[model samples]
Target: MNRPVFMDFERRWAISGLEDLTGHAGEAVLPKRDFLARLDELSGRVEELGERFGVALGLDHSVFMGRAAILGLTRRGQTSCNGTCRLIESGDGWLAVNLARPEDVDLVPAWLCRKGDDPWKAIGKTARRCSTADLIERAAMLGMPVAAIPFSRHPGEGRDPDLSSQTRRLSRLDPGLRQDDGLEGGRRPVVVDLSSLWAGPLCGHLLTRIGCRVIKVESTTRPDGARFGPATFFEELHNGQEFVTVDFATPDRLRDLILSADVVIEGSRPRALRQLGIDRDEVMSQRPSMTWVSITAHGRDDARVGFGDDAAAAAGLLAWDRAGRPVFVGDAIADPIAGLTAAEGAMASLLEGGGHTIDVSLSGAAAWVADAPEIASW
Candidate 1:
């Protein structure tokens, strides 16, 4: 596949630090699809939106692999590039499990129903005896990010049937926020970012770069999970953004912040926000011109929890090794991809006069990129 000279340079620069971190050493693993091209396409969309808003924004594929560079991550074959997630073989199929949080590690014994010193070893031993379906169901119940690796010839060749159904359900939801007049001349958009981790924060960061006033909000009880990660990586996505902490018990301040924003970015399950008395419909009703970006593992209605690694694996976004076995493509790739897609969606909606809820799912975004026409033609 021949690409433009500029694109070739962008791909090489994007994958520079990531070259030795995707497949096993000396195996030369590559993704079934060109994820860099997909990223380039999304970056172009964001750039176009910036132009419409009279902002000069320069984006490239380097954003997708920025985390790997910050963390100095390397590929570990069945293990995720970030070293927090793993692809384990179950009796029926393969599953990706991510123990990204300390609490997630604490729940490993309960997930396996036995105590063990090494979580990965214990998980692998128990997974060999249990069916992938059962393992996934139990992990979902525990709020852990676990996904069954569906079979596919290419990154987006075949998706999990359940994911397709969820996507359809998402499509039928209330279409975008109520339409309003586009952003006023000389007025910068206000963005309330209530999302944690990479995807949502990256969206906020991009918006900030695009001349938006972004406020990063977190609950006092449940702050951003990324705070525990590498400090520099966290700062990269959040620099120059306002920070606020709200008390979940009394989230009136959070509601007020959402109501006062031109764009709202959140990455929580639907029910989680509903339980906190922050309904999307209600909020949008109060502010018809607002654009809400909802990022999730699946659709808004699906209760299944997912992180970047498991969600990408579930979407069949994997690299093939020399032996033809699947290996992870990059470090929580779904997160960055979904983040860029969400930002682009937000920008497009705003350019169209607002009143839109951009429902971006990590797995769904990965599937779209994997199956992008550009990748197929290339």
Candidate 2:
């Protein structure tokens, strides 16, 4: 079989998608790294589940880069920005911004303190006026999703290189069963997706492909902003799932909604969940067999907020352009990587049948991708 030509991003596809995500070794064009070869090994265990239970739980590595090529399969002449999400200049360094939401368009004017009919032009003009630090600080304060790409070939966030991309542990136990929740192979697990945008939703998407009954629960006040992105792409990720809207004001109903799931997928910070009257500890303690998958830009242990591309860059998953500038590896790469990684862990926990939690950090996954040697130059 001929391998897909990833062009500029062939290297990351080689590492994160190929070598790391799938333990396939062969004659390839891109460089390789052991940046936790075991990270994607969780996918192998899923194969075991399929064989043991007689289900078709196969994983396609190509799907991991859906942002780059999935939309190309359509007739549209590419939606919005050109490929690679527009790497622009900041006063000090370059920062990555994904206007994944309609509200984010309004943030550009507020960020620059200037008004313009064109969002990109206004963002470009405003970026020239301030340093990367200033823009990041201002974006953080305004709740705007933006990140600065670092030139040093590391994530803008300084996390230890040795940090594992995911944490899967037996955090709690089901009082009901000290046993494998035997699957009939025809059973569909329930997944409650409380995440928006890419990462967590992608995890839910992957789960649905494997016969999981996924329910995408969004807040009525603040729905998934990704609904404003390219229609085909959004639909591709959210297809084959039931969608529901809930009011965060009612904690009892929210708790019941999540508690009903066999697995829970979420991306908010801890306090944000608490504010909505949802606590992982309480939920897991109550139902130890529920697998809670928490996707954070940082980690569940920390409350830092981040978007996919910026957090990946901060975690150091970027290559330098010929001009020696840090370039975003691909479209919000950490989102998909963390999504795939988290899905693997979530599936394992579900079959194991325990109240276990998987902490899938976007920065950690990005760092795993960035830890590889720069791919071959074009």
Candidate 3:
């Protein structure tokens, strides 16, 4: 394995006085995959924000990068279904199946007509019986987060962005030399999180811990998938936040919520948001100091969907066993990677005075990590 393992922690990346504000309570030889500047990229945003805002952000790697946010629930004897989300063989090809929620587990018998207590047993039997397409259909029908493992290793290695990875496409909605909001201190910014599931909500959770006034906005029809996780874990993530349910069909209410926020965090596709008359770029233009964070499976522009494990594999982050079989590197790593990255990006944009839209796509983030040059190769 020629992948780079770690980088020396940088000192200039300190966040002043954040320890007291966000209790420092936590925290990997990450595989030798391309993730050379990943930590720096995550922390550099804070450094820039600190330099500009005159606030020393005391960001601890143990807390911010590690599973600190999830530790609270784990200590309470709750666990996430990271192992359940695995690569399984299908009639056509391999795909990732995640039954993190009880609802997803309950839907198994209905989807595959397999009756058993163990969800994995039913899932494995169903996957063996069904083709990849069939499994995908059933997953969507049940609103499950599943993705087909991408097998194509692009002919080109690292020239074009697509050569390294595809599906998740990130683009700055409106480009211009903008000014920051220049909020010096003592003003707690309002963050309206219009995202669900792992990555987007995780970003919101991080922001909330760091003293942002985060408001989680869900749809009356479709609620957050995290609600299916352990009760304690779900509460840990959403504990200190306000909640509001809006009818996306109405659109006006959701639009108003986002526009009024100092920061906007969303995890929907472009078409979905557009249908609700919520434009990220338009919002940024309207409020110069506003930061909009868009989190998605693929990029906001494309509809190629994925969850954590498959998206990481789709971006070429698979770990090979001694026999050379491809296995998941870690537990739903893409979700945490994207979540932490989005949080840092959001904070950087806010601290530097705003007027930016950061698009953090799971597949894209995984692809970038995969493309990081091997340490020895470098």
Candidate 4:
């Protein structure tokens, strides 16, 4: 009579002890209390990280919503319209939320994910562009969970500016002829620049007015700052401009895009480029006719990590600190200047018959002014 009592109890309490099934036999489900506790721990960790990294998580109870709510918003044509909520699901659950801002260029995309052991895990995302794989990977290596997404101007799924004109644009250019000086008819050359952040993308923007057909590529993985970053500069309008960065669906696709480019530029360090299978020599070898440009804070060997402004400041071009303490420059000047320099360099190399690798260092480029120290007598 008592033998049947244990079997009945076990069947009724199946969701009781999953985390601690040590020697209890068959698979056991973790108790709801334990699961919730684990989730809380993860959320707490995320908060800790937010504080440490100067990031604004701002996640609270109201910020936590169901998957249905997110999908509803997407269907109703509101991606970044969520009023502070995080979607969560256990086993086979997934959540999708639009990252696009109202006045912006619909840069952000929906994110999809299944709950993992950790709370704030990003399985995947969809956006017009993301930050950058290198940046994301570096952030991840430093303990951040970042995902990339892809967004297009195509008119589909209730999206505006639908249908990417990539093919159409490609069709307009001469197939075999190389682009010259980025200015043929005194109009900006159409450049499909798929590089993000500083360096490469900045080069494209500078060349945009110089007759370069620059189409800043973006995906869920890498978004331009003009739309997704802090409310500053061009992004301050909240128009969600998608040109703040470059993006790609896959590395292979990005490579193909690069192959089609007359001048390919990047800001990654030598080591980073090598990791991405894009060493200067390799790129020159692969194309043998294209101009490959790479920019960095320091030369190829220096381990200095930098952003355009920081690099420019470090190189003493933008100006010293805010207090004017004779400190290093404090704005992001390296990227623009370096990008401009690279474009001209590419143009020069092309004019001289291409097949050259240009490595522009923020420090070196900015030092051009310092080269004549006598002018500092003022």
- On TM-score, the leading prediction is 1
What are the per-residue Cα lDDT tens digits for candidate 3 across 283-375?
A: 778888888888887676656556776677656665433333346544455776787778767766665556777888897777766666554
Q: Lowest-scoring 10 consecutive residues by lDDT in candidate 2?
A: 73-82
Reference-based TM-score of each model = 0.87, 0.71, 0.66, 0.43
Better of 1 and 3 by lDDT: 1
User: Which residue segments of model 1 deviate by more than 4 Å?
Assistant: 1-18, 152-161, 166-184, 372-378
Counting only residues 3 or more apart in sequence or on different chains, how many pairs clash (N, Cα, C under 3 Å) in candidate 4? 48
* By TM-score: ranked, best first: 1, 2, 3, 4
The top-ranked prediction according to lDDT is 1
Clash totals for all models, in order?
5, 7, 11, 48
- Listed per candidate, the RMSD to the true structure in angstroms reads 4.3, 7.1, 7.7, 24.7
Q: What is candidate 4's CA lDDT for residue 321?
A: 19
lDDT, candidate 1, 1-378, per-residue tens: 455744564466335545566787556465656666666787787777667665777775567777877887777888887788888877766788989878899999999999999999999899989977789889989999888887733455444445563341122222234344334465888999999999999999988887789999999998998998899989988988999999989988988899999999999998999999999999999999999999999778778888998888888778767665778877888898899889888887766667888998998888766664433223
**TM-score (C-alpha) between model 2 and the true structure:** 0.71
**lDDT at 171, model 2:** 35
Each prediction's whole-model lDDT (CA): 0.80, 0.65, 0.63, 0.38
Tens digits of per-residue lDDT for model 4, 98-148: 122232112111222233332223423321123333333443243222211
